[model samples]
Target: MITDPELDGEWDTAERAEPAEPLAPRERAAAAAARPWLWALGGVVVASAVWAGGLYALGDRLAAPTVAYRATKNLCADFKAQSLSGITGDLRKRPVNKEVSHPAVDAAACVMNNVPDSPGDFYVYVNTELHKKADPATEFDVPSVDDLANVGDLRTEEVPDLGERAVMTSWAGEQGLNLKVLDGGAVFNLRVFATTFSEKGGRPATDSNAVQAAMVQDVRELMAALRK
Candidate 1:
C-alpha cells in the first residue's frame, strides 16, 4: 500500500504496441484488380435474370400450340353427317406446314361421305392458322380462301355476329363449304372438300344450297366449343 508500484510506473506501454504490417505491392495490386471483375460478374448475373423474366412473360405467344388433340376433336365434332377417317396434329414451331390447296394448316384430317364413284376419302381440314395481325405477310393471304368463291364459282356470304368476323363459302368446284372465322391472333378455318374421282377424273358433286346453310350453323356451334 505504501509503494503501490510507484503509481503504476511498471506498466510497459512499448511492449503492448505492435507494428502495422504493410502489404506487398503485388498483393495490393491483385486485390485492386479483382474489384472491377467482381462488379462486372454481378451485373452479368442480373442481366441474365432479367432476360429470363421476359421469356417467361411471353411464354404463351412463343410456346403456342401448333396442333392439339382436343382442338382437332372439337373441330371434327362440328360436322355430323360426314364420316371422319382420321385426325393428325403438327406440333412444329417454325416453318409452318404448307398445303397447295389451303393456307398453311397446323392440322390435317380426312373425312368420307356417301358419294358414289369417290375412289377415296375427302377432306375435313382444320387450321388454327396465324391471324393477319400476327403474320400480316402470309397468314390471311390465303389464295384458297381469298379466291375460292370466285375461282370455284361458289356461293359466298358474310356471317354476321360470328367470332370477331366470319365468312361462309361454298365451293361448286369441290361440292363442300368452308367457314372461316377470324378471332384475335388466330384464324379458325374449317373446310370440307368433297369431290368424287372416277374414270371421268376428279369432278365436284351437284351444288346444294343446303350445304352452305348447314355450314353456317355448324360454325356457330364450333364457336361454342372453342369457348369451353
Candidate 2:
C-alpha cells in the first residue's frame, strides 16, 4: 500500500543492465588468423574436385580418336611394308580423310585384343591412279559394304586365307587408289576409303570397275602377308 509509482520506478532501475560493445576490427582479424588453414583447405578441396572432373571428360573424348588413328597408322605401315615388299619404290605416306578414320575402330580394337585369337581386321580404302593407263570398261568398282552384292563376279573370288582374321583390299583409280584392311572382330572393323580423280580427254576419269578389282587383289595379298 506504499505509493505504487514510487515502488515501480525503483524496481525498474534495480533490474536495468548495460549493453555490450561490438567486436573491434583487431579482434576479428585475430580470430581469422587463428584458423587460417580452414579457408585454404576448403579452396583446395573445391579446386581438386573441378580438376578431376575435367580430366575425366577430356580422356573420354580423346580415347576413341586416338585409337582410330593409331590403328589406321598401323594399317598403313603394314600395307606399305607388304605391298611394296618386292617392288623398290618410294611409297608416299599421306594422311587419309578423317571420315574413314572413325572412333569406332579404336573402341573395337580395345575389345578385339582382349578376345582369344582375335585378329584385328581394320579396313581402309584408297583411290589413286595407277602409274599406267587403265581401260575404262575394265576399271574397278567401288562398292560400299552394304552394296557387297553389287560387286558381281568380284565377290565370288575366294577370300584369301589370312592366318589371322584379317583381310585387305586395294582399288586403283585414274588419279589415285583405294585400300582397306579388315582385322580383329567384325565390330572393330575399321575401313579407310579415299578417292582421287584424274583428267582424261579433258574430263575427270574414274574407273570404278578397275578400283574394285585392285581392292580384291590388295586384300588377297594382305591376307597372305598376315599368314607369314
Candidate 3:
C-alpha cells in the first residue's frame, strides 16, 4: 500500500469549508412558510392511511356477536309477565326474571325458579346462543343429556316440525328433561330439573311419558311466542 506522509502520516485531513451564502430576507420568510405546508401534507397522508385501515378493522368487528342483539331478541324481551306466568305454571308470584346478557358468547339467559337461591327442582332456564350459520344451531347435546345417553337412559334425536331444528331428550328414570330448539340463527335450550324428594332422601321417579309430552309442549309454546 502506498502511504501518504503529510504531517506525520495523518491521512484523513478535513476538507476546507466553503462559505455559505446567507439567504435574502424575502427568501428566508418563504422557506419558513413552506415548512408548515410540508408538515401539513405529511399529516394528511398519515390520516388517510389511518382512515382506510379503520374501515377494514370495522368490517372485522361486524362479524362478532353483540349483546344488544341478544338482549332484544324474542326470548329476552317479547314475553310479558302474564305470558311467562302461563308457561311457568303459576310462578307468577316470583319476581320478574331479569335478562342476563353474556357478551363473550353473544348470548343471554333468562331464568325463573320456584326457589330463588336454589338451582335445583322446579326452575325454568332459557339459554340462547347466536351464530352466523343458518343450520346446525347446536352441535352437541347438553352434557347431562349426553351422560344419560352414554349410560343408556336418555334418547336424543332430531324432532322435525318443532322449529327450524330441535332435539327432544328424556331421561329413562325421569329425573330431568332437557330440550334444545334451534330457531333462525339462534340456538335456544330449555332445561327443567324437577323432581319430588321422598321422605327417605331419595328422589321419586316421575312419569316419563307425561314429562316427555310436557317438554314437547314447552317447545311448541316457545315457537308460538317467537311468532308473536
User: Compared with the true structure, what per-residue lDDT tens digits does model 3 show for residues 42-146?
Assistant: 999999999989998877445543221233353534333343233334433353344444534445566665455444345566666655422333354445444
Ranking by lDDT: 3, 1, 2
lDDT of the structure predicted as candidate 3: 0.56
**Steric clash pairs (candidate 1):** none
Model 1's alpha-carbon lDDT is: 0.50
The most accurate candidate by TM-score is: 3
**Model 3 CA lDDT for position 54:** 92
Model 3 scores worst on lDDT over the 10 consecutive residues at: 197-206
Clashing pairs in 3: none
Q: Hey, what RMSD does candidate 3 come out at?
A: 16.1
RMSD to the hidden true structure, all candidates? 17.4, 21.2, 16.1
C-alpha lDDT values of all predictions: 0.50, 0.36, 0.56
